[model samples]
Every structure is written in C-alpha cells, then in structure tokens.
Target: MKQWKPAASALLAFSLLLAGCSSEQDAVSKPPATQNKQEKPSQPANAAAGSETSKEIPDAVKKPLKIAAIVQLSIGTFSSQYAQGLKEQVNEFGGDVQIYNADNDLSKMASYVENAVSQKVDGILLDHGRADALAPSVKKAVEAGIPVVAFDSDLNIPGVTVIDQDDYSLAWNSLRTLAQDLNGKGEIVYVWVGGFTPMERRNVIYEAFKKRYPNIKEVARFGNASQNTALDTQSQMEALLQKYPNKGDIDAVFAPWDEFAKGAARAIKQAGRDEIKVYGIDLSDEDLQLIQEKNSPWTATAATDPADVAKLQVRFLYQKVAGEETPQIYSVQPHLVQKSALPEQKVSMNDIGKYVEGWGKSDAAISAWMETLSKEQKK
Candidate 1:
C-alpha cells in the first residue's frame, strides 16, 4: 500500500471543524463483557448504534495517521479475516496500516517493531509477540512517543493496552461440552503447543480439565504451529491414529486452535474413526464447513468473530492515539457453538451472528465520533 502523509495545515483546519460539529444521534459505548463458561452468551450492547452521546473527533486523528500492524504469524481463515477487519476500521480514520508479518519468528517480529519505530509511525499494533523478544523494542517505540495496542501478547509495559479473547472460557466452553458428551470418562488426545500466550492460557484450563476428570485419560499429545499448520497437524494425527489403531482407543480430541481441529477432524474422517469427536477453540467459514460435513468428527467450538476482534484492536489503538483513557486490559467474550446450533445450509462470518448472538458484534472502545468518522468515510 502507498504511504499517505497529509499536510499539517489541512489537519489543523479540519480539527477545528470536527471540534465544533455536534451530533444528535447517539452511539453505544460499553465495557467488554464476559460470560460464564457454561452459560449461553448474552447479547452485547449494539456498539454500531445506541443512545449515548459521543465525543468529538480527536485532533490526533484529523490527519491520515500512519499505523503499523506487527504480527508473529498470519495463518488460517481467521487471520485473513482479522486483517480485513483491521484494514476496514483503519480506513474509517482515513489512515493506512502496514502489516509486518514475522511468519512465526519472534526475533523477526522484534526487528519489525524496531523498523516501525524508525519509520516513526503514528501507532503500533502487535499480535502474538512474546514479551522477552518484543518488550524491549516496544519500550523503544514507547520512548519515541508512539501509542501501542497489543492483542494476545505478553508485553506488560506501561501505557500499553492489551486485548484478547477470554482464552480460559474458550477452553472450558469446548472442554466442558466434550466432558459432558463423554460423561466425564473417555480417552482423549490432546493437541496443543506452548509459547503463544493464548495457547498457554488455554493449556491452563486443559490441565484443570485433566484433574477434574480423572477417568478421562490422555492417550497422546502432540502439536506444533507452522507454515502449513493444518496439513502438518493432519499428518501427525494420521500417525497417532495408527499408533492407537482401534475404535475405542481415542474417544475425543481436543484442539484449541481451529487449524489443529481441522487437521485432527480430517485425519479421523480419513481413518474412518467416526467414534472420535473433535472439540476446538476458534471458528471460521472453512471450519464451519468442516463441522457440517457428513458425520464430521469436529463438533463444538468457542470463538468470537475474527473480524470483530480486529475491529476492536483498531479502535483501541485510535483511543490511545486520541489521548483518551483506555483500559489496560480488555477481554472479548467467547461463545460456544455446537454443530447442532448451526443451520443446515452454509454460512460465512458475515452471517454467523444471525444464528449466534454476540458472535460478530462488540461495543468496547466505541465512541460517538467514531460513528461519524465511519459515515464520513462512506460519504
């Protein structure tokens, strides 16, 4: 994408117009909500529209702000959707976001942050970067006076707002349903890897599940996130099925990431292991299609819309840039989706919320001026 740098004089004149403009239309603004792992998700307040008055557009956003989106990995449908949402939201601000994809290399991700700092971008958005590798660079960026917002990162620096899905619930929502389906007694293969913050948090819940259900034994455990995560997972799972080599040897497979779930579900289907059920976290159009396959082993999943997640990240970043107070941490609630809850026909993220409440909507970090900004973009 071409870089956009608007003149300072134009921004000054626009900011005055924004500060004087008033809107009678109200916008909804609410803190991010959390739901009990076992309960159905309640409707989130409509952040796209509502009854609360909104503040004027900040002077910081009057110009075409330059944003840098640094990511550790960008794989799967969710990743693509998230990027699309982020771009659309940033577009509303008449800004551009340059994505620096590290392709799963933490060290490379660090250098991208340093590069962004060198560019003196208006703001930085981080995704899935380790604190040890990324924190120092983040400090340098903060020292340079750039606002930062992180999603599913371990960076604990001051003046940084962190955002993530409720990983604990994402795990328990699927795990609990699996335990109930198996009556708390069955052989389960655990598909997981450590290092990523979301994976690590979800693993904590997995450990609790092992202790909670003593009878539900673990037969095999193996996973790795790579360039071809889904295909690699499928090959590994195929080998695992061979090792077990019996109908009852593996009763259920718990894959917290959709890629792993898709891999495991595909392997099970190929092996004719119809008895095994795959429970996973995160959902996408491809994943939903897999779940709806004839006698597909993949069943329940817990997730928020990947697009909505990106939308929130962009809003939070703008909030910081606008010099508004922002929560140090924000958690977007995850919802449980069972195969039985989906309609018989196909659907995509654009329509998932029609069947699942709160799947594709959020009100966190929304302000009245944002609605006006969005309309301005369309006009």
Candidate 2:
C-alpha cells in the first residue's frame, strides 16, 4: 500500500463524506437498472489499472489520494451520467472520490469547497457553477498545493484546468442543420432557459445564425430559466402557436437543450401542427427517441457526450497530478444527428446504457473505442 499526502482541508472532508454517504444511500435505494447506465464501462478498466498502478507508488507516497467532486445538480440524467463516468475513472485509477452537490445554490458550492479543503483531499473536481463564488476557496486549495480540475464549467481561475463542451460551435451546428433543413428562409421560434453556461453559449451561436442566414427570422424567444421545466416551455410554446396561428407564419422551432425541444414538440403535437420542425442540443436517450418516431417535430439535435467529457477531465486531472504537461483548456466537440440518418436504426436510452454497461465487461474494447474517438478528434 502506498501512503500519500492528503491535499484537502479538514472541513472539506466531513461535508464531502456526509454528502457522499447520502448520495450513496440514494444510489443504493434505486433499482440498479434505473441508475444511470453511462458509468458502468469505465469503472472496471480504470479500477483495474488504478489498482495495478498503486503498487508503482513508492512507500514515501503510500497514502491513497482522496478526491472531492462537486456537481451543479444531483438528479438530472445528464449530471448523473457525468458523475457515473467520473466515479468509474477515479475508481479505475485506484483513488476514492467523495461526491457533493450544490443543487444550483452558489452559497452551498462555496461551503462545499471550503469543506473539501478542510477535509484535506488530494484534489477536487468541480462541475458547472459560478466560478467567482468558488474563487476564494479554490485559491485556498491551490495555495495549499492541492490540484483542482473543473469540468462542464468555466472557471477563469489560475491553476485550475477546465474541460468542457464547445457550446458555441454545437449551437451553431445544430441551428445550421435546422436552417439547411428549412432551406435557409424561415421563421423560427427560439426557446431557451437562460443563465446556464450552455444557454449563454447558445446565445452567441444564435447571434452567429443571424449573421449566417439573413432570411431566417427569429419570430419569438422564450426563456424558461429552469433546465427541467418542460411544462413552462410547453406553455410558452402553446402561447406562441396561438399568437401565430398561420402555419406559414413559423417555419421551425429551435431550443437550446433537449428538454426545451421536447416542450416545443409537445406544444406542436397539441396544436396538431406537424409542419414545424424542431431542433435542440444534448442528444440524450429521450431526444433520440423523439427523432426516431416518424411524424415527430424533433428532426435533429446536437450530441454532447457527457461521458466523454467526464473521461477527458479524469484523464487530464491524472496527467496534472502526475506532473505531466496538459492543456489548460480542453473542449469536446458536439455531433449533429438527424432523423433521416437513423433510417432503420433505432435510438434509445438503452443504446446509451449498453455502451456504458459494456465498458465494465472489457477493457480492451473500451480502449479501442477511446483510441478511435481520439483519432476522430485529430481529424
């Protein structure tokens, strides 16, 4: 066994352990199948590698590395998938991770960071949240010589590496695909939930869309403010449809995320308007299902692989901790998937689940997949 120095502060440890135990309880209470399947594959390979690697650590640094993970939310499928991936990778590396949730509360996040510092963990992984609110605590960790890695969030802080999606490009590509489907000229109703990083990035992409396609007019814009507020989005869309009753008045609907797109689709279904095409981001199982169903309003979506982002963050953090050179910022590219592309193929949550579940069964297969992905990125 290798002993290593703990990097977190005392308070950080207690809060993290308490929160982690609570989360573990919730995880234990859920049916195994219901738990996000995205994390399963990476666990076995990383865990086995980690166990073997631990033996390489000299007795001088024999302590286990303690890591604290802070996430923006605890319940969503996207967040859950990211968490699962992070955990699997950490376990694979032969380390322990204590998870914490801010529940979108900035103050709780600040406190969580403080707690992790007190607990004296070796490192901390931060998900989406306010970077400024965490600055003081993160600075303290850096001053104390603990490495901090941020994922799915932008923290313009020193000594913290950020691994996140290329949201601007993703939004632009998704909208472009929608525009191409509409043949460049159409009235689009853009629905968005503001404040989140993805939404902010989408705003930039929306601006680019205006420049790229001069004829595509944004007839209406709705802001829901909550990520999972489907009812609010649907209500907004219904109002828009009523206001613009003429089928020729609106050509398409664009949403910043899948939930918003789903909301728009629901509104279109209720209105009995199948002519309006819909587009959004985050290609989760549900979004793919909507695309597969013929006569559905959802025609396309931009795919952001949360599991891949999580894995990149873990790998980058490992390099940083190992004193190897790493990029200060890593951006994961999003893919555009269309309904027509999946002719005979079906898309389901089970498909995503199968990919993640398979990782635990074979390290060679996962490694091969990762290598292919890397090669694609280079191209």
Candidate with the greatest TM-score versus the true structure: 1
lDDT of 2 at 86: 84
Pairs that clash in candidate 1: none
> Considering every candidate listed, which one attains the maximal lDDT?
1
Off by over 4 Å in 2: 1-64, 348-379
Models, CA RMSD each: 12.6, 14.3
| lDDT by residue (tens digit), candidate 1, 6-65 | 112222332333332111000001122341121111422222212135556778877788
Off by over 4 Å in 1: 1-55
- Candidate 1 lDDT at 200 equals 80
Residue 25 lDDT, candidate 2, scale 0-100: 25
lDDT of each: 0.79, 0.64
Clashes of 1: 0
Residues 125-175 of candidate 2: C-alpha lDDT, one tens digit per residue: 888776667788888988887788887565656567665565655676688
TM-scores of all candidate predictions against the true structure: 0.86, 0.73
